[model samples]
Structures are given as C-alpha cells and as structure tokens.
Target: MSKETETMKHNAEVAQFRFALIAPVIQGLFPDASATAYYKRVSAAPLMLPEGTSVKYSYKTLENGNPCTAPEGLIH
Candidate 1:
C-alpha cells in the first residue's frame, strides 16, 4: 500500500479500537459519576489489540475521545 493509504488504514483501525474501548461507558447505562470511574478503571488496565499486543489509553485521552462527550461527532 502507498504511505498515505497505510496511514489512513492505521488511523481507521485506531478509531475502531477506541470505539470498542469506550463502548460500554457510552451506552448511557451508567450514571455520570460511574462513567468517570469506569474510564479510570479502563485506563488503568492494558487493552488487548486485534494483533494481540496490549496498550492502554490514559483517562483523559479516553474521556476526551469519547463520542458522547464530544459536542459534535458521529457516534460510530
């Protein structure tokens, strides 16, 4: 693939990964305080990627990237 194509594909994958990581919290089943705690707990652990490597997003990053938290954006 071309460099641009590769970068786009990687970005798409990362977005999907981020969505999956925050899916539970965005479902609106939890109270606001619970959601905050959930993010902290999730950020405290490593996430397993599709390729099997683990990575973790910090609480701020995850919360900032969450679709529901954003003022405007397509949620998934």
Candidate 2:
C-alpha cells in the first residue's frame, strides 16, 4: 500500500478501537450512576491497542465521542 493508504488504514483501525473502548459509555451499556464517574474510572485505566501498545484516553477525547453525552456536567 502507499504511505497515505497505510496511514489511513491505521487511523481507521484506531478509530474503531476507540469506539470499542467507549462503546458502553456512548451506548449507556454500563451502569454507572453518572458520566463523570464512568469517564474518571475509564480514563484512570490504560487501554491496549491493536499494535499491542498501551495508552490512556484523555477526558476531552472521550467527551467528544457522542455529542449528546458530553460536557455540560459530564466531563470537563
């Protein structure tokens, strides 16, 4: 694949991984009392990516997922 194609492929994989990580929060699948606690708990933990690397998502990234479930009083 071309360099640009490779980059796009990686980015698409990353986006899918991110959505999988935050799917519950976005879909209200978890039973957290509020979004804040959920974000805090999740942000506190490390996430493993497809490349076998570990990372932690920032509050802003998680908050920006679903427009309906963000800011206001959910995340800072």
Candidate 3:
C-alpha cells in the first residue's frame, strides 16, 4: 500500500483509541456529558494537570497499549 494510505489507517486507529481512552474520563468528570458535548468540551479546554503529579511509565504504556515515547513538555 501507498504511504498515504498507511498514514490514513494509522491516524484512524489512533483516533479510535483516543476516543476510547477519553470516554471514561469524560463520563466520570461530566456525568451528564454526551458524546457530542464531550467532543465540544475537549475542543474548548485543555487538560491542566495540577502540580505534584507523578509520572508513571506504566501508565503511558497502558494509554497507548504499545511501545511509544511519552510526549515532551508534558510535565511542567
């Protein structure tokens, strides 16, 4: 397959995984938030994790369920 087709497939997979990961968090935080509302809120607000949050390598692996590097500038 072409590189463009592979990239598209990879992106689609990532989008699906991201949605799945966020769904539970959204529901927990905003019990009444529908999928539409969740998307809207996600578009509007960024996650501002407060200070003193520890970084866990296991959590990163769990999030992607694959071997990947944690995003830079994530901890402030």
The local distance difference test score of each candidate is 0.73, 0.71, 0.44
On lDDT, the candidate that comes out on top is: 1
> In every candidate, how many clashes are there?
0, 0, 0
lDDT tens digits by residue: candidate 2, 1-76: 9999999998888778767656787788867787766767777878788778998877656766645765443222
Off by over 4 Å in 3: 28-76
Between candidates 2 and 3, the one scoring higher on lDDT is 2
> What 10-residue stretch in candidate 3 is worst by lDDT?
67-76
lDDT tens per residue, model 3, 40-60: 444453332223233333333
lDDT of 3: 0.44
Worst 10 residues of 2 by lDDT: 67-76
C-alpha-based local distance difference test score of model 2: 0.71
Clashing residue pairs in candidate 3 are none
Q: List the residue pairs that clash in candidate 2.
A: none
The Cα error of candidate 3 at residue 72, in Å, is 13
Question: Candidate 2 at residue 55, lDDT?
Answer: 86
Clash-forming residue pairs, model 1: none
Runs with alpha carbons beyond 4 Å of true place in candidate 2: 51-53, 70-76
Tens digits of per-residue lDDT, candidate 1, 1-76, equal 8999988887788778778767888787654477778779877888887557888767777777776786533233
